[model samples]
Every structure is written in C-alpha cells, then in structure tokens.
Target chain A: MMPTSPVIPLFVAVPLAGAFAIALLGKKTRIIPNGMALIVTGGLIAFSIIAMRMFSLFGVHTYKLGAWPAPFGIVMVLDGLTAFMLFTVSLIAFLVILFSISYMERYSGRWQFYTLFLLMVAGMNGVIVTGDMFNLFVFLEVAAVASYALVAFGTEKHELEAAFKYAVMGSVGSLFVLLAIVWLYSYTSTLNMADMALALQAAGSTRVALVTGVLLLTGFALKAAIVPFHAWLPDAHPSAPAPISAMLSGVLIKALGVYAICRVFYSVLGVSPQLSMLLMVLGVVSMSVGVLLALRQWDLKRLLAYSSISQIGYIMLGIGIGTPLGFMAALFHLFNHSVFKSLLFLGSGAVEYATGTRDLREMGGLGKRMKLTSAAMLSGSMSVAGIPPFAGFWSKLLIIVAAVQAGYYWFAIIAVVASMLTLSYVMRIMRYGFLGELREKWAGVREVPFMMKLSLGLLALICILGGLLLLPGAREFFLTQAARTFSVGTQLASRILGGV
Target chain B: MSKERQPGMTLIVKTVTRLTVGLILLYGIYVVTHGHLTPGGGFAGGVVIALSLVHLMLAFGGDVAFKTLSKSGAAVLEAIGALLFVGIAIIGFGWAGFFFNFLPKGTPFDLFSAGIIPLCNIAISLKVGAGLFSVVIAIVFLRVAGSERE
Candidate 1:
C-alpha cells in the first residue's frame, strides 16, 4: 500500500496533537479548545471508517513506519480487529467529545478537560494500532495517566480519593505489564509482537515462556477488569467526569485490557487448551460476580461501572471459547457494548448535569425533564440487556450458540444469568431515575444541552443498529478479518519481516 | 490561598531543598538512561524524581513550590513522556525495515551502544519521573482542598 496511509497513524497523531494543543492553547480560549477537540474526534472517526474500508477491500494492511520492514523496525498493523476497534474508539470518542462540549460546562478548566480527553483518545489509538510491545506499554501508560487526572478532575474529596486509588491500582497494573514486557524481551530477545510470536513458536514451550505468558495474562487481566483484579474499577470508573466515565466504561478497558490480551495470546502466545480454559474460568467468574455487585448500587455511575465489569465478562467468555464463531461474537459484543455503554454513561452525565445528583433515589421523573437523555438511556439499557433486535442480543446469542457448540452448556447458563442481571439494573434506572413520580427538589431541572442530546441520539442510533454487525458484509469488513489475523498467528511475523 | 514566605533560614532550607531536588532529577536521568547497560530502569528513575519533589515540597511548602510547577503540569509531562517513548519505538521501525527487532548493531560498548535500549531508558525515565511526580503532587495537593474527594 501507499507509505503514508492516513488510516493507521492518524488515529494516534490527531489525538496526540489535539491533546497537546488543547493543553497549551486551551489555557485561554475554552471555545477553541473544545472545537479543536471535536474536530480531532471527527477526523478520527473518518480515519476509522477508512481503516474499516481498507480492511474490507485489502484484508489486513500493515503500516511500516518510516518505510521500514518489520521485526527490526516498528510496524502498525491494521486488520479487521484493529479496524473494528478503531471504528469503535473513534465513534465513542467523537460522541464523548460532543457530549463534553456541554457536560463539562459545570466543571472548571474546560481546557484541561479537553486536553486530557484528547490525550486519552490518542493513547487508546496508539494502543490499538502500534505493532510494537514497548509502544503498547507507552500508550497504555499515557491513557492510564490521562485517565487518572481525568478521574480526579472534579477535585472534590471523593473524586480525589477515587482518582488516587485508581492511579495506584492502574500504576500497579502498568508495572505488571512493564515487568511482563521485560520478561518477554528476555525470553524472545525481541520487543516486536510478530517477531516474538515467531520466536515463541520456534522456541517451543518452556517453563520460562509459560511463566511469562501467565504474568502477561495476569497483568492484562487486571487491565481488562476481570473478576480477580477488578476491585479498582468500580471505584475508578464512577469518579471520573461523565464523559470520562463513558470513555472508560466504553473503550478504555477493552482497548488496553481485552484487545491486548486477545492480540498477545492469540497471535503471540498461541492459544492452547489450558490457556483457553483459564480464560473461560475468569470470564465466568467476572460475569457472575460483577453483576451481583452491581445489583445493589444506588449510585448511578457506580452501578454502571459494576455493570461494565459484568459486560467485560461476556466479551471474555465468548472470546475464550476459542471458536471462530466465538471470536466473532466477542469482537461484535465489544463493538456493541462500546456504543450502548458510552450512551448510558452520557445519559448519566446528562442526569448528573441537570439534577446535580447521581443517586437513583434522589432522581425521579427525569424523563419529563430530559426526554432525549431518558430515551437514550432506555435504549442503551435495552441494548446492554440483550433484548431482541438490539445489538447486544445478537452478540450474546452468538456467544451462547458458540459456547453450546463448544459443548460448554454450564457456561451458557452463566451467560443467561448475567444477561438477566444486566436487564434488571438497566430496568431499574429507567423506572426509578427516569419514569417514576416527579421528585420535589429536582422538579425545576431542565434538559441537557443540544450537543449532549445530539451525541446521545447518535449513540442510541448505533445501539439500535448494533445487531447489523452480524450481517455477512459488515462481518467481513469489520470482524472476520480480525479473527483471521489472530488465526494467522506466526505468519504475521513473516508478513511483517518481509519473509525473512 | 496565599502563603507567608518563610523569614530567612527556612528560606535557605527551601533553596537548598530546590537545588537538591534539581540535582537528584539530573542524576536520575543518568541512572535511567544507563538502565539496560547497568541497572535501574524507568520505574526507579521516576521514584527518585518523586522523592526529590517531596523534599522540595516539605521545605518550600505546598503553595510556594506548587505554584510555579503544578500537578497538572506534571500530569501533562507524564503523558508527553509516554508519547515520546512510543514515538521513538515507532521510529525504530525504519532501521530493521520492520517493527520489533534489534538493528544490525550500534557502536558496541559505547554510550550509543544499544540502539533502542538507551532510547527506551530515556523515554521510561521521562514517563516515570513525570508519572511519579504527578501522583505525589495530586495526593499532597488534594489535602488543601478540604480533603473530601475520597
């Protein structure tokens, strides 16, 4: 392909430059900062769409940096999986930035908020696109640090406390990932993903390799907020600015955690029965436990954060099944969830914006005040719950079918239970926060701004059409090629290295 | 929001504190860059920066020291450091004509010996120093904000 395809690096560059500019120039004019950030997000969405088209037309495209080969130089690989992720990341980023134009008016330092938000987008894009391991770690830290600051942006007691806690846990997670990178470097004597994969295959299975793989898995698991290492997420995700909360719940964990694990394990480590089983166990546990914890949360964001954990469980469960159909389902859910989850969080932001409260009990009949936000939340909740016709349903169905096909009946039951719990919480929000009798204190509240409404509407539209991803053409363009990329395994090493 | 500047000797202590912190920060870069060849890496270098900042903050007090250099400043630095590290790795893609292996060789037993290793160390130090500094500043600064954000 052409040397300077805008599809690959644009995702990272746009956000990085936007972030820097927002930080420096934003100090004076909030309007320009917000406008610049929105423009970046819009450009990213266009880039993601380009990547999607490229993947569909060309299969997998590798962007070799500085016109270099691979294994020796850094390469950015754009496959179906990456394009899917890019599409999701950019779409959510665009919407979140849109929502923030209005949502952040309540918070001071609009420039700071926009700057951090753009940095976060750049980091996530970097993670999704870069084909280098060290590159991945850097992006991971960038996104993590930005998130830490964004979480504490409110600077109130709870926001600070949560941001500090999130920063500590996240740093620990990053440390683990860094250590894993060190170990991988020591094992394969390489820092590139494809080269390492080839080396691991050549080296065969050794105790050191096994240990390193386990460490990488554990570190990424913490990042993905799997059951065992998920304590920090509930505290962290809820405390951020609403747009930030949406971004975290929507894409951050999936990109930094889920996407990394899938890429490393499937392509680098080469999935085995043992590793697959381990993933299954983790997925099942996270699914069950996360939902159970979320059931009682009266705090709106906290409950949604907990639900995010449970949803991640579903994504993992499907991907862990180790079938092509299962992989497809997992990637699909990842896309769908980003849509609905971001929508839900944005809806919560609107509610928070108008009512100045997050407690469900304090909210009542907000549907009257915020018709668009309520409608968006209701649609998002349904989509998340796997109601028929919504995007969540198709992915969930595929996962259940794939599990059943894999002969894991018990796991299917777990998936169903998780689905029910998801429905329950989403329903609770609609009933208590949106539809119930009007509360006395919040009666004077009004609808959120036009930008917020527009973003929510766009996301809601995506949630409704999420199921369309399963159609053959969409599947071919977005997900199948990614699954094929992972399945291609060590061949990716040769492809990047020019058949060295 | 305002602070009474320390009378005199304490101010000297503050001056000593700032210089000491700056020196430590300089030394930290050396250790972190030489990590692959010797010992220490990004994490260790970053911690040293935080330690130096803590000393300065204690001697100079939060207001006076924090004003010139804010936590938000450190946070942005951390992010930029991360971006720089990733950016270098991307640049390495040119040499091997690929994304992930060591080039033919650099200088063999020189300051520029390990092609990407030194660069990696430098990037890590930046990220770590800024990261650690941001964390410390956030924690300490929050204390003056009524300590309720928890």
Candidate 2:
C-alpha cells in the first residue's frame, strides 16, 4: 500500500495551496475563491476520514524527514490523538467554509479571508501532527498570526480594538510559551517532543524542569482562556463574522489552547500534582466565573463566548483528574463542546444576520420567520446547555462522574452548577431572541440562504449524535487510543523509537 | 512632500538606516547560532531579522520594499519553512532511532553538539522571519488600505 504519511500532511497542504491559488486567481474572478475554499475543505474532510481508517488499521505511524533515521531529524507522527483532532478540526472547517461562502458576501476582501483561513488550517494541522516542541510553537504562531488578521478583517472600530487586545494577549501568551520551551530545551537538551518526554522521564524532576512546567502551564492557560486569562475572548469572538466566531470558539481554542496544554503538561512535563491541582482550580474557577459572567450578557454571541469558557472548564476538569476515566471524559467533552458550542454561536450569528442586530432585547419571534435556522439554534442551545439525550449531556456527565470518582466532590458540584448557568443563559437567548413577539422592523426577514442552513444543520447533527463516538470500536479508534496515549505519557518516545 | 533639505541629509538618513539594519542582522545571526548554548533561540533571532526588514521598509517606502518582499511571497516562505521543519523531523524519526534524537552527543561541545536541533533552529529562523515580517507588512498596508479613498 502507498504510504499514508503524505496523505496526513495534505490536510494542511491542500487548504494552504487552495488559499494561495485563490488569492492569486480570485483577484481576477471572485467566484473562483469561494469554490476553491469549499472544495479544498471538503477534500480535507475526506482525508481526515482516510486518516482515521489508516490509524485504526495501522496503529500510529511516524514519518521521518528526508529519509533520515528517527532521532536524527524532524519527524511527524500520526496516531490516535492526531486522528481525533484532525477530524474535529477539518469537519468544523468544512462546515465553516460553506458558511463563509454566503455569510461573507456583505463583507469585501473575501479572498484575503480565505487566504488567512487556510494558513490557520495549515498551522493547526502542523500543531496536531508534528512530534516536536519547537515545531509546535512555530505552528502555534502560524495559526495565531492568521487568526489575528481575520479577527481584524472588518476593520470596524470595535474590530480593531478587539483584535489589538487579542493580539497583545496572544503575543504575551506565545512569549511565555517560548520562554517555557527555552527552558525545556535547555533542561532536556532536545527539541523533539517524544525525545523530550523521555528526557524528562530519565531526568526525573529537576528544579529547572519543575519551574519550566509552571511557565508552560501559565502560557497554555492563557491560550485556553481558563478563568483569569479569559478577558480577551468575549470581546474578540463577538466582533468577528458569525462563522469565524464559531470557528474561534469551537475549534481554535481547543486546537491552540486545550490540545497544546494537555500535550505539553501530560506528555512532556508528565503532569505533576501541582500541575493537576492548577488545572482543577482553573476548571472550577472558570466554570463558576465564566457562567456567572455569561448569565448577564445581552449580546447573543458574547453570552455564547462566555459559556465557551465554562464548557472548556469541564474538559480541563476531566483531564486534570489524570485517570483513564478522566482522559476519556476530557476527550469526550472536548469533541462535544466543539460541536455544540460552534452550533450555538452560528445560531446567534444567524439571528444577527437576519435581524441586523446582536442584542437579545432587539430580537423577537424569529422562530416563525426562520424555522430551519431557529430550529438549529434551539437544538444547539439545548445541546450546549447539557440537556439529556444530547451530546453535551453525556460528556458533562462523564466529567462530573470522573471528578467525583477522583475525590474532587467540590469540583464536581461546580461542574453541575455551571451546567445550570449554561442552561439559564441559553434558555434566555431562546426566549428573548427567538420566542418573543416579532419586531415590526424584522417583519420581512426570512430564513438564511442554503449555505448557512447547511452548515448549521451539519453542526446541529453532530451536537446531538457526538456521543456515538464513545461506542466500542469507534472509541478505540478515536477517544480510547488518544486518551491512552496521554495516560501512557513518557512512554511515547519508547513506543515511536521502538517502531523504528 | 517637502523637498527643501540640507545638503546630504538624504545621504545621512540612508547611511544611518543601513548601519542600524546591518547591526540587527549581525545580532540575529549571533543569537540564532548560539541558541542552544546561550539565551535566545530561533524565535528571538528571527524577530530581529524581521525587524531589519521593517527598518528597510520605513527608510525607503512601503511600495518600494513591499514589491521586493510582498505579502504573498512572505506567506509562501512561511509555509516552506514550516514544511522544511516537518521534513527534517521525519528524517530524524526514521534514522535517529527516536523522533528528534541526534547522532550520539557528538563531541558534546562541538558545532553540532545539539544534533538536529540547530537545523530546526535555522528552519524556525526562516519561519519567524517570514511570519513576523508578514505581520508587520500586513499591519502597515492594512492601515493604508483602510484610510485611502477609492
């Protein structure tokens, strides 16, 4: 069989190539750019599926650079963890690309948006598959630089302000991460991730390693926007276009923040008691603080943004438990949150698009006028708020159960309370924005176009059925393998090297 | 634009700019090579390199400099750097017996003391230079694009 290594890299390469070609050609023909983006994302989804199958059959493959032996040059490793994240990212990108086709019409410079969008995709793919710490940092910056520009795409007064805030905070976070990476390299005397993990294991708890672990924690926490570091999110997310908002809340935070944090803490530094406690406290604090802040927001997307922080807390809490069950629960919730959270944001954005306002007080009775869009929003909100039978319920249940089992009853209780807060705000949006008396000004409004409806439907479907990923064979391929990979920790190098 | 100027004022401006940029380029190379041994690594050195480009842009003009280092071109360089890094890592994964492990410590204090890490450093230098320069150029041009009338 032809090797799957190149197939894996295509997740990034296709989008990047599409983006560049579109930028050059779309300048001459507007129709070409959107079509290329859509086609490229669709291809990515296909590639992600093939990757999933390949991982299931082959059990984690590592591709070396320039025919060099392992440990002598750069390497890209594809495993269960990489498969799971690649699927989430590309599936979301697929839908968002479709949504952008129509939604971006009101805005000029669509080609630039597509260009940056693809660059961001490439960066994310780089982060997921590359097996080195330094490479991770480079990819992080790649996605970050693109997102910064996209956030400022509109160039509105607020857009500039929000982008500046996001950029500054983001740069600060990257700087901290860079500093931590410097320490890791110096201590381990290596830059590759699996090698570094082994090095940390062999070295076994140095003062410098411990100190650097804290720096890594602080930097990743900022990216994750867990409680104390979440200030820029509400402002930045709401200022972007709706689909971009969904992408930001749904996948960007997970890819850049949660995924990277876990990889470094669990796989690299080996997650000390101090790091575990730090994660748990951040989880509980974010759960309570994010939801409480969310409950008072009148702007629809802002409320969703705040709730995203709360949901992220759940994922963190699960992983922070550092058990087999905790890993399962965390990965489970990570997938679910990406689905439901993005769905809810897109719903709010649809409301904004139709009614020409984001204020909950300004919107009313859109349910009658825009049934499909409204239904998608309603389902999305329900799923995100953890109503049973929806995907969110299962993940949140797993997390809370894992927390209690881990003897963190207080953390479990906070998780439950946060769910209630999520329910309240989501219900508030449905009532004030969707179910209230119809505004006379919006009397003529209709359902959004086909592209937007399609994207929303896809996400809504995922949110409701995401729990199915936990089934036996599927779980082994996606969640179990990934979680076990993390649980295995420090053994990663031995496994990859042994393969060689 | 004001035209009247003291004799050789333009020449002085050009010389100062060149001097400063040359110093920064020298420093960037120093920092990047000594990354594993010293304080700064690929990222800091790359930024320094990019700053020199910004200096050139400011000294000459956006239009003149951008034509040479356009946004599309810088973005392509960024991707190439990222690709090269991955390529190098893949080679290490296959040959070195472990991902990112280098040839047996090698003279511990030699030029290749850190194995493939220095190579990764150079790749990152290119990426950081391209990425940061792109950001600077984007910010500058976007500001102009926003203010200009049709």
What is the TM-score (0 to 1) of chain A in model 2? 0.97
Candidate-wise lDDT, in order: 0.82, 0.82
Question: What's each prediction's TM-score?
Answer: 0.83, 0.83
Give the per-residue lDDT digits (tens) of candidate 1, residues A218-295: 888888899999988998888898899999999999999999898887777787889988898899999999899989
Two-chain complex of model 1, DockQ on C-alpha atoms against the true structure: 0.15
Q: Tell me the spans in candidate 2 whose CA falls farther than 4 Å from its real position.
A: A1-4, B1-150
Off by over 4 Å in 1: A1-6, A66-69, B1-150
Q: Which candidate is the best by DockQ?
A: 1
Model 2 per-residue lDDT tens digits across residues A276-368: 888888888888899999999999889989998988888888888988988898898888888888888888777777888999888888898
* Candidate RMSDs in order: 5.4, 6.0
DockQ of each: 0.15, 0.09
Writing each residue's lDDT as its tens digit, candidate 2 over B31-150 gives: 888777788888999899888888778876666567668877787677666656656655554553323455555675566677777777887888899889988887977797878945
